[model samples]
Target: MDPLHPTVDPARFAPTLDAGATFEEYEALKAILLAGSAQFDVRAVGEVHTARPSFPLYTASIGSRDPQAPAVGFFGGIHGLERIGTQLILHYMRALLFRLEWDELLHQQLQKVRLVFMPLVNPGGMWAQKRANPHGVDLMRNAPQRAESGVPFLAGGQTLSPWLPWYCGRPGAPMEVESAALLQVVHDELASRPFSLALDCHSGYGFDDSLWFPYARTRRLMAHLPEMFALKTMLEQSHPHHAYSFEPQSNQYLLHGDLWDHAYDHAPPDHVFLPMTLELGSWLWIRKNPRQLFSRHGIFNPIKAHRIKRVLRRHADLLDFLTRAAFAAPRWLPPADRRMQLQQLATACWRPRRAP
Candidate 1:
């Protein structure tokens, strides 16, 4: 076994990821964080042990530590095959850290908004190049929530076998270590705030990049529909040419154990939490490069150097937009009367249309 991925029990599970390459990238990221340690609070929030190796999950934050401050978190790598998600976040973090040296505006923004990053939530999975963690439990489907109905068999989540994709793990088993660590980060960093937003980056679903809000377990509108609508409005107005699609995850498909839904539903009532998933469509990549369909990782990530750079640059502005949106939540979150109007509009836009 590679030193970077020492086996604890070789017979129990087979390693499928490129552990050496992934860990090397992880080391470089950790070094960058250390280099800019003075600008942020960084820590290994938790660790996950695979049969071959153990991976530390790190969460870093910059800006105010005040409980009342608004926060926005950027998460990636929940699916190991979606390497671009992790890279996008790490790239944004690098930009922020570098800007801290001279960007006084960012310094002032930090005074009001907290920024958190968990760039590699499933390093073990990334190392193995598998969607699930080392144990074959899909972290996205490992949360406790279950869909009442309308789930698409195994695609929604299943316990038939770990060998199948979208396996939710054994019934009643504890959440995976990476999943728990992510939830803990949300609880500590964003749950206490009066208003907060979280964006979990992912890919490999459709042809167009999409921004999906909560209630993944059902098609029902969430309690914060008005707030979600307002944010969508603001984002549209701010970036008129942005091509990303925005909707509830259920619009795509109902699924069990969506972590963001679990977090949003369980957030403090006094606080308004809006968690989103940025699913960068990979079909477009495959369409452009037909050969990519043959590579597992290629289906979920942009493989060519130029394409990868384009993907990063395309989403960088949106990440910055979310940060600024968090800072301005008080200004645009909608007043009581306006919220009702937005709710009606949200229903018209997002809810499934009834037969007329």
Candidate 2:
């Protein structure tokens, strides 16, 4: 059976974020979530200034009933042009909220797992539909990943030139406002309740859905291979079209101080294994007929639309699985080993050429 044809209401699966939509739309969505009830908490992380104007960086949390339940976070829109990421999170939220209303199973899962949605991490960059922030700094690459001279290269990578889209900012200066804000929020939240799993959504990639873990250099991350493999299998079974692959790091053709990298590095050792970047597909931004008039951001492309629906459904399944696995296991798998096996399986699914 094709997973895309599930009998859920399409309207319930629709995204709250519109393509090429303004910051006002995002604020509107935030407002809606905030006014709903005490179950959700909507707050501003900070603000970013763009050529057009400045906008708030927002984070929304759907508090779980269980205090000790593992936290799950979904983040997107780090790259301004990558609107699909934001849409994916919105779609997931919609499905989750819908299910929570009618399904006891879903309600149980929600009570067991806290979910934090950072739907638009780079609102200023997203507003212009550009990759970098208004200052032309690629927030992903601006992380303090490496050291220079005798100090950390904290603000060194933000410099912009005519040659590239990813301009890391000036050395010793604060990183882009967006990245700094997200980092602070995530850090504080995790410090209190560590996350068991996280999915940072992105698009404009290969045809298959790819899940990338920590950089290959981080050998310690190899421990969580089993859990990652199980999660990928569950996702594939729930939504078959999503071809699952795992890459250790960004390709040489596409390298940066990506958000996932920073997230994994900062998370607790056991929690570190849970971070994965879900790269959807190249088809997300274009339709079957390239010339056919459609949303410039292609938010409504028919093929992409179906894929989004499928992913949202699968995400629901994944959420249930996570709740069961985290609480049921007598002894949870260690982080490093589980990650290695996940990388192995993902290599087979994503990079068949490199499959052993």
Candidate 3:
């Protein structure tokens, strides 16, 4: 599809939530998309059991007629309360359908790459506006490799407080339906597809955008190190408002059964690229300093609302950079040169520290 123009307004893509919009709203939105003429399939992966109602979680695919195109999976809404990620994926999908036209470049790229989206993976948790799924399980922390009990770092972390904003869920148990369903999907479906890259989005942290790569302890999974670095550099260079940062997948401070870690372990050896988590800023649903607006009423709070709009606008540019980077890398640079490029890009984005 011809890439959507940069001048497109953010309001056009904003999701409209009605008085009682819950998982039902998500289903409604999915139906609307399926009804359209666009090429999309809504595969019901599994169902979530919640107090409100049980709902099916799905993955949506959109692309041109290129079978071998590099595939990109966009995952969000792992944390129920982190609604922005879910909205961002939905907005991106809407743009791809209504605003974008598949041109020669888009067609060729689509053939060369596939884009998969899991817009609302934790419908039960989202309905309750809680971080954990229906059974109060934190889906992100339930990955088999780093199941809370299996990983010591996550066992006694300070972020595990129930009194805190988010509860990390029962250790060692894959209690959440949402997480379990996703785990199955990755093993059954994603394992079979020639998946090239994946980006899982979240919020309620750093003010700047942070890109986290897998196996933080070992950089071995980064076969396309230079290209990855170049992609990060291009993103940072193009969007100064969004700061770029990277860390190992198994950082003690952020250890868990994270989706990225799962993707790294399960994806085919040749796929090479590890899944990255894009952590955006604090939650718009929470009232905070410099913007003391209440969560309930701040959806329309002028300043907060503007910042949300600004982020949405920036996301469009980020998508463009990602698309170009994926397509241009393997074709343009040799292995050694690609490594050098990545190193340069990494150095440019890394912030040097000064002695106090």
Candidate 4:
């Protein structure tokens, strides 16, 4: 399914930051940063400057930082309007922090795994309440790779103008500041480990929430297809009835400059980097509250207080499942002798079959 990205009035999306606007999410993030600093190794990755205030891009990590330790990263807010995605990460962080005070089992798990978070990557865009950042660039599409063919018009990234949505910056231009910062975080924190998994949260798509793996730039299988399927099987066996459509982003549509694809490609050939996006379906939200269609923020976020809570509460298990999977990756990952069998299973389950 496509975003069916609703266009607000042209004047409302004039590609400028609302300097006077305050971002409640950024402020809440700071509070959480302070509260968790005692346990988390927190630091600013970069700073996003607007006309008046500059938001500090932050990353907080905990657990083992050992080079060999498996790592899991939880990221959100790459698109400003998807506040629910950011909230989900923040909720996971807050809950994890509260549990650390007494949950001994979690602490033991942390010792074996590294957990990192970049919950609010596009605060400036979020502050301005626009999907694109202040420069009007879609960070998800800012990577250097191009879709050689078969990309839908504007939805797959464009260069018509910054005024247009999903506008990738001018050709040959460097990535946006937020996009670069996120990539740097991925390289420094996630790819350094031998086994790592990154989940970047997003919303504003189909009816059922989805778990999309990479190769968004094409319909081919990812390099680590066997490992990806192994992880999927672990989740399904553990959760039994979780509500997620696990598939490749290409299964929905092809797109250009998918950052995760770049990140997965850039990882050292020996490393296993599995990046998945949790696209929380917002059409369901819009259906339940038809009035949401009129507002851009409402289109990507849950407007009602209760629905917002429901959205946040349900995803914590997924996050927890990831850390557990990472901690026990060596155990669940198929042996060299079994990789071919797992790959065959993965292809059967995910690869689209051609009509005879």
- lDDT of each residue in 1-356, candidate 3, tens digit only: 43211122223223445535455437545554554334564566788876545666777665533444455667888977777777777777777665445556665566555567787888777787777777655677666554333334433222465444335565665546677666665554444454355677787654445677765332233444555565555566766666556654443233445656666676777554536777775633343444434562233221356666876776766665666655654653336645665676554554232211
C-alpha lDDT of all candidate models, in order: 0.86, 0.59, 0.58, 0.86
* TM-score per model over all chains: 0.92, 0.72, 0.74, 0.93
Candidate 3 ranges beyond 4 A from true positions: 1-28, 35-37, 64-67, 100-105, 147-175, 184-195, 216-227, 236-242, 249-252, 283-303, 332-356
User: Whole-model lDDT for model 1 versus the true structure?
Assistant: 0.86
TM-score of 3: 0.74
Residue 113, candidate 1: C-alpha displacement in angstroms: 0.8
Off by over 4 Å in 2: 1-28, 65-67, 146-163, 191-195, 216-223, 233-242, 250-254, 270-273, 283-287, 292-356
| TM-score (C-alpha) between model 1 and the true structure | 0.92
Query: For model 1, how does the per-residue alpha-carbon lDDT over 1-356 read when each residue is reduced to its tens digit?
Result: 22111223222223326645446447656765766566667778888887676777877788877789899999999999999999999899888878878899988899888898999999999888899999899999999989855688799999889999999999999998999999999998998789899999999988999999888788788999999998998989999999989999888788999999899888998789999999999999999999999999899999999999999999999999999999988888888889889999999999853212
Clashing pairs in 1: 6-52, 17-127, 17-128, 17-129
Candidate 1 residues lying further than 4 Å off, grouped into runs, are 1-24, 353-356
Question: lDDT by residue for model 4 over 240-310, one digit each (tens)?
Answer: 89999999888888788899988988999899999999999999999999999999889999999999999
Clashes of each: 4, 27, 16, 0
